[model samples]
Target: MRFDTVIIGGGLAGMACGIRLAEAGQRCAIVSQGQSAIHFSSGSFDLLGRLPDGTPVTDPVAGIAALAESAPAHPYSVIGAERCARHAETAAELLRSAGIRVAGDSRRNHFRITPMGKAKRTWLTIDGYLTTDDADRLPFKTVCIVNVEGFLDFYPEFIAEEFRKRGVECRFGSFNHPDLEQIRRNPSEMRSANIARVFDRDADLEALAAELHRCSEGCDALILPALIGINRNDSLELLRARVGCPIHLLPTLPPSIPGIRAQQALQHRFRALGGEYFLGDSVLSAETRGSRVERIYTANHGNIPFEAAHFVLATGSFFSKGLLATPDRIVEPVFGADTEFVPSRSEWYTLRFFDRQAYQAFGVKTDPALRVIKEGKALDNLYCAGAGLAGFHPVQEECGAGVSLLSALHVAETILKIEN
Candidate 1:
């Protein structure tokens, strides 16, 4: 089971990385346990539109600029207006390649591209004040963000207050959590995994539909917690059919996510091109010496090892245990025994709470190249992208798939360029 690259997580970053690497004629595969995170995605990407210094953002350039200075250890720290534009251009190119169209908004963003490649000038704002316009206009009257219950990731009071302060009509949907006691009492596959499993099943999950019907009673659209109970096509169908509103899915934050299928949807093209899928596969360990990584190990039926001239660690964060956020949550432990990770602490969760709530979940701590870094050290042969990287909160702002794609593309380009 050798490959040019062995990506750890099956989420957005790993899938996207695998796709591009495979498309570049590199043999790539990803191993993972659960589904991806984008399944519960609202599917709308955006930026916070402000800097840590409180500078209001009129464009992506400024927002990215702020990210650089603040997030010196995460993602890119040098993305200026021009580079941001370059990012947008690169994203448009990638989208076009992916058979999707994405344009900027005439109201807020500078340009607009769609999956369909339609071009239109437009304006967008929380209120009808002509706040911002972009080259591409946003569709729908309200931008709905979905959150789940019991998860308690996003505090209801704070979110509702923020929306109220902004005068935006935000709605929520009810998702079931592991009533572990109740479930243990009535052990069944459907009830074993909580709401996420419920959404994936066709029958017996009707309780979720009933609850969704209740929570989404009169809201224009119901934004649900990340893919936990995300029915994808069915969710959109049911919400549209029963709730009668534009359903926008906000991807659930890391560690436990339900968007694996969404990643599959986006990765279908690459797989169709002959990419090998090692679903439920994993990396046991890697044997590396010096700056080069020689081989890695895994186990399915027997001991499986993979050899690669080059490698990419799109595995993910402590939650996903890519970088081992804590003791209980660990990953392959790249580098060696001395490579320690974040301390185990419940309080590691920041105070603002909502501050860490969004889909990106604080992102990953990386350098400009989007390589995961601990103490100013970039994990050689290891590059990171997506929610795992710490920087601007994508959940709080508009996480244009562009950011992840941009970092992923840039890293891949640099890797391929350097390797050749």
Candidate 2:
């Protein structure tokens, strides 16, 4: 198959890039082996939550400017502050068009409640996650944390305890669902994904909504876990019909239902925009003509050749296996691109486990145009985005989705310009 662009990895970056191209009448394909990091995301897209000095960021736009000055090699810096802000707006608009409601933009951050009842500052969060306007403290009079009975991943009591310690009016409550009883009996069915499947049914959602309606009384807002529905918008609509108050969801454990919904929404949008998505398939090898990669071979479809005018690599960090870490060094696996990292492995980690680690910032070396560079030579037609591009520490700066979305959008525009 031949296309305008072929993106490797079906993560946020890849999907965003493909969708942008597909929307612009360019044929695009995303080859994905399995689930992306979106499955484990908090469903909140953060943009510079904290500074390099561990100081919490108040104004994210200002923070970006400061970041550009401090970390010029960072993806945000390479993308430019004004362009990063523009891409941020573009990402929010793109997700909104995909039926997801993002609450913030590049100007500032939103504070959402975590599973542990801690406040998290994020740039753009899926609607119904943040119950309060205050990022530092809970702004509600009475908060009710609802837990599904036998849901092991969520801890309502723990959240309640934290809220109480902070002198906030909060209560912990649990509701029993008929569907959960059977799932709880089986060990394998105890996962968030399994429970989310059960909730996907309209009857099951209505039943849970009914129970929540009865349990939550005189509470300012209902703080539920992120497992409200698998279909996201549909599930949220089903519950909203029965429930009376505003509801917010705390980020759940792995196989995050909201995350899955977000990922699916982007992929579905990409397909709807005339983009092809090959799931359960990975790029095996690329045959480059001089500095350009003309065709790529896939693991599942080895014999069939996939060709594109431009290529984007959004395979992600070590967690996504985009960049492999060895005892001595870290390497970009796909193109053997020169990676940004410390010379010695001993400098990869720091004494403070929670602090920014050098390894987190390790990824492929790229030019201002995001083209992969090895030995100071640029891979002309190939571009890299998301966690695969080196420089900024995602966890420390809380710019995971920011980098992914912004970089993808910027790269897509760059490709368009190059086409022109």
Candidate 3:
């Protein structure tokens, strides 16, 4: 089937871009595998209305946020932060309208104690959002934080100490893995969703539960990661029924399932709007002739022959790594496309994983028009968005999904020339 747009990589950026283009009345098809990367998402959308240079704005939308970025000439000019914030709100509203009500507001969310009084860092809550607060002064006798097996993040010690400092007794447990040593020796300070990645593979749930049991043995309240299992609703109902303690779910970061749920919600909306889906597809590369896309090749699939259309590549960075092709150590994954990326990985992430700056860390080099550039030249018909476009720190302002959606919307605006 010939699609007006064939978007590869079904993760956040890809999903966002595809949904936007499809909603813009373009015939679009999204190619993806089963794992949407939504499985690991925390689900809260960040909509900060101000840019980093402190440029004042109204409110954040779903696909974009407001932020100050450095253009070639200016020293830190404001750009996508507002755009990102805006996108988040729109997408979230779409979710709420779908009956899975999500919460967001112009007001900044606050941090608070978990029901288990685990992590010292406060959490945020809107009306439909998960409610959390600083548990420092709260008199909770026994509270527990959950963990998982082989999961490379979640700090039991850090959380325990924080609760201790706050004068609250707390317990740290693992829903990720059972091995204390494995959880203890996680080298990656940032959490990995490896266990969650394998959630639907028909593994032993009882064993998984036994491991959770091992971690939660003496806890009164069990604080598990949000989107605890493969099935969101089922996980909520099942775990609540099975676990004896008071069950509370907390939001997680990138590779978050909530992000994926946002994606799914968008996809359903897109399809309802007559968008086509091409699951598990690969476009070999673009065949261009004289500053225009000629045709797209696919191995064992079909071809996308384009004469004069634009393309948005939201292939994410190393974590999602759709843009990273690992062939014989040659590096770069997006076919033979040259990326005007940071010189090295050192510039990509800050040393501190907990630092919010690292998450919005990387993507493609492009102009303000969202065009991918290499040596001062645009890639003709191609544009980049999402985490694949580079250089916005998502963790810093919690703007990952917002950026993904906004830039895609920006691409749509360019495609449609929506003059605001």
Candidate 3 C-alpha lDDT tens digits along 99-215: 355554543443433323343221123122234433344434567766664444445566567667766577665554333344346556324344444443335455555555665
Model 3, runs deviating above 4 Å: 33-37, 45-66, 69-85, 97-100, 112-158, 171-222, 225-229, 232-246, 251-266, 302-308, 325-338, 342-362, 396-398, 418-420
Ranking by lDDT: 2, 3, 1
**Steric clash count of candidate 2:** 0
Error of 2 at 358 (Å): 0.6
**How well does candidate 3 match the true structure in TM-score terms?**
0.65
Q: How accurate is candidate 1 locally (lDDT)?
A: 0.50
lDDT of residue 301 for candidate 1 = 27
Identify the runs in model 1 with alpha carbons over 4 angstroms from their true place: 47-49, 53-56, 69-71, 78-84, 92-261, 327-332, 336-352, 355-380, 390-403
lDDT of each residue in 1-420, candidate 2, tens digit only? 999999999999999999998888899999988899999878788888888778888788788888877889989999898898888888989999887777885776777677787778888888777645574467666888888877788888788877776667887777777778888997667888888888888788888898778767888778888876776467776676688877778887787877898999999899999899999998878888889888999989878989989999999999889999888888887788899889888899989998679999889999999998977899989999898999988998888998998999999999999887
TM-score of candidate 2 to 2 decimals: 0.96
lDDT of 1 by residue, 83-147 (tens): 55565565455544654323444225532222122222221211111112432333433434444
Q: Clash totals for all models, in order?
A: 57, 0, 70
Q: Where is model 1 poorest over a 10-residue stretch in terms of lDDT?
A: 123-132
Ten contiguous residues minimizing lDDT sum, candidate 3: 69-78
**Highest TM-score model number:** 2
